[model samples]
Target: MRSLVFLVLLGAAFALDDEKIVGGYECKPYSQPWQVSLNSGYHFCGGSLVNENWVVSAAHCYMSRIEVRLGEHNIVITEGSEQFIYSDKVIRHPNYNSWTLDSDIMLIKLSKPATLNQYVQPVSLPTGCATAGTNCSVTGWGNTMSSTADSNKLQCLEIPILSNSNCNNSYPGMITNTMFCAGYLEGGKDSCQKGESLSMDRRNKKEEEGKKEEEEEGEKEEEGKKEEEEEGGKKEEEEEGEKEEEGKKEEEEEGKKEEEEEEEEDKEWKYLMKFEQQS
Candidate 1:
């Protein structure tokens, strides 16, 4: 199930930040924004941490309903493992076009600082100028086939840097100064865009509904199992107690019989009564 409802609003992708997936491409579940979920359920996009407090990703990655998880392994949605960081602010390039994919960049400010770990290191940014044809990595959860399904795992592709002229020719007017194109021209298992399927609002709604149904079913099953155990245990305890009570009653009867026999043996009281009658 999917929910088309954007837990958050939405935005476009970045154009110039071609910082590829040079390092490790971590794909984890849809945990909250900051914390880790049970599984790495989804990869919305690839981002580089510019600082402890800021992460640079495609603006499209930001949804009013979006969540980010840090330090995740598998894609399972866990409730509390991940810390959900709300986008304190979203700063997109001044001149961004949703149609053209130009300046499709944004900065995300985490409410709290990101803890630096081996798996979660910030990538170095190109400040001065990048030479043409410089090698870089592009990592994302985008679809391998534009028409087919998205990759199940986080994917990384390496492509040589293209001169601005060449990039413009490749993508026409889509490649801008803020954006850099790195995917393969032949288009074989090499592409970088943030997130896989910008889960439509309708899909998201369906997903949420499915989750709610699963949760309800799980709760019901738990309740039913608990009741069955309690009833079974009560019956066993009652049967054991009944068996012990029968044994106790037999012991009491044997004790009474021994007293009666001892009384029968004591006849001296009868002899005293007869002596008194003769006097």
Candidate 2:
């Protein structure tokens, strides 16, 4: 069987951020404007507002009907910066394979433009590549520890970007070009939860997709050229066949004319022989 990757929206929603917490610190409400929570009934996953109408997140974090909470802090208490709205559309990466978790990214289109304020805003994309050992921040509403309950308020933690070689040693044959490792090698404060929307360099992903498209286009052009050449060859063969048929018809007509002349000459000689006999 050719394995096909299918997207399934599990009715259950537990924040992976819920799963990956250990010693996470709490933050004040409305501090991170671009930070958003995807809430179906409760906060399921974290997302970022890349545009007024778009939210970028992990494909693994999909919900059937998403209620977007922007400028949200604590899920339990209501705040002024909090804007709750329904999503207009949900689009997963075209090449996303749920089984492989390959290209695990998704985009949500908002029905209405998010009202950008101090509490609700967009995050800027990285201009350059992240160097190994650089400290970066990760935020989510996951549990503080494996034994504890999932947090109602948002939390943030600082983790270092691990070098590919070092990360490979830790995970061993699991890292991919679409994925990288970022967390403490010691493993005390890692975002251990099925934390949605780990900071991935989406620009690199887009560039890779573009390169694949260009290669496919080149192959299509080559195939088209081959087809045209085959058609031209068939046309030439047809013309040669017609020429040969015409030559055979002309030879047949010449042969008939020669036989008629010979028959007429024989008749004339016979008539002359009869006249001589009569004289």
Candidate 3:
């Protein structure tokens, strides 16, 4: 998906910054492990779930195909995990523009509704379609170190909402009213990196190889089946030829017997005529 690729590029362009936190800013963990696992692929740059029907994340997150695995505590590869839910649909704000990164928000609709537990409850939205400056928490699975995917805990940091005017000045032609900005005012402390691009590249290569192997094997099997059918058909034709030859031989024999009987009858008639003349 173009969106997924775009997101990786975007992360490279904006590496995460580890600068000092603003005075009141604090980072917290999500209460539920399930909440953290569902949004694993994305960095905590900007995203939220609006309701059971929709997960509101950054539009850039949607640019890539994302798997939202619910109910997992950590990010280890495991089978039959209880908190696994895949995203069925993605809806980015209609007005989103990548050049500006404005209207950066998006909504993800799940194929099935999520079960609510204390650890897996929905985050609250600001009342009244709140404007920027309304305090909110940002959570994600971004790497704590540069250019790496971080551990799978639901890491979050609290940020005061910056006014749309201020965000525009910072990102210019890169911010829109439909979106908001957070993090330190200084540039270095807040960023996403290019290293994530490498991880995705590796994954793509593996997938391509798998497909190629599958196709080759399928072709071989099909060829073998065709050969078998041809051999069977030839055997059937040979049997039919033998039957036709036998039928022809029987017909010729029947014709010869009928001719012999006609000859005998003609001879008997001639003898009777001669006897009558003598009398």
What lDDT would each prediction earn against the true structure? Answer: 0.49, 0.69, 0.48
What lDDT tens digits, residue by residue, belong to model 1 across residues 226-249? 988988888888888887898888
Q: Mind giving the per-residue lDDT tens digits that candidate 3 earns over 1-279?
A: 101111221322343353112132223433432243334454333333335655555565564445666544345554343444567887877987766555555677777777765445555443244345443433345555543455454444444455667766776775444444554565443325221211012244457788998898888888888877887787777777777777777777777777777777777887888889889
Give the better candidate number (2 or 3) by TM-score.
Answer: 2
Q: Estimate each model's TM-score.
A: 0.49, 0.63, 0.49
The lDDT leader among the candidates is 2
Q: 87-168 in candidate 2: lDDT tens per residue? A: 9998888987776666677888998999998788777655566678755567777777666677888887666677889867
Q: Which runs of model 3 end up more than 4 angstroms from their true locations?
A: 1-47, 63-65, 77-82, 129-135, 187-279
> Which segments of candidate 2 are over 4 A away from where they belong?
1-18, 194-279
- In model 1, the Cα lDDT at residue 182 comes to 42
Error of 2 at 109 (Å): 0.7
The TM-score measured for candidate 3 stands at 0.49
| TM-score of model 2 (CA atoms) | 0.63
Winning candidate number (TM-score): 2
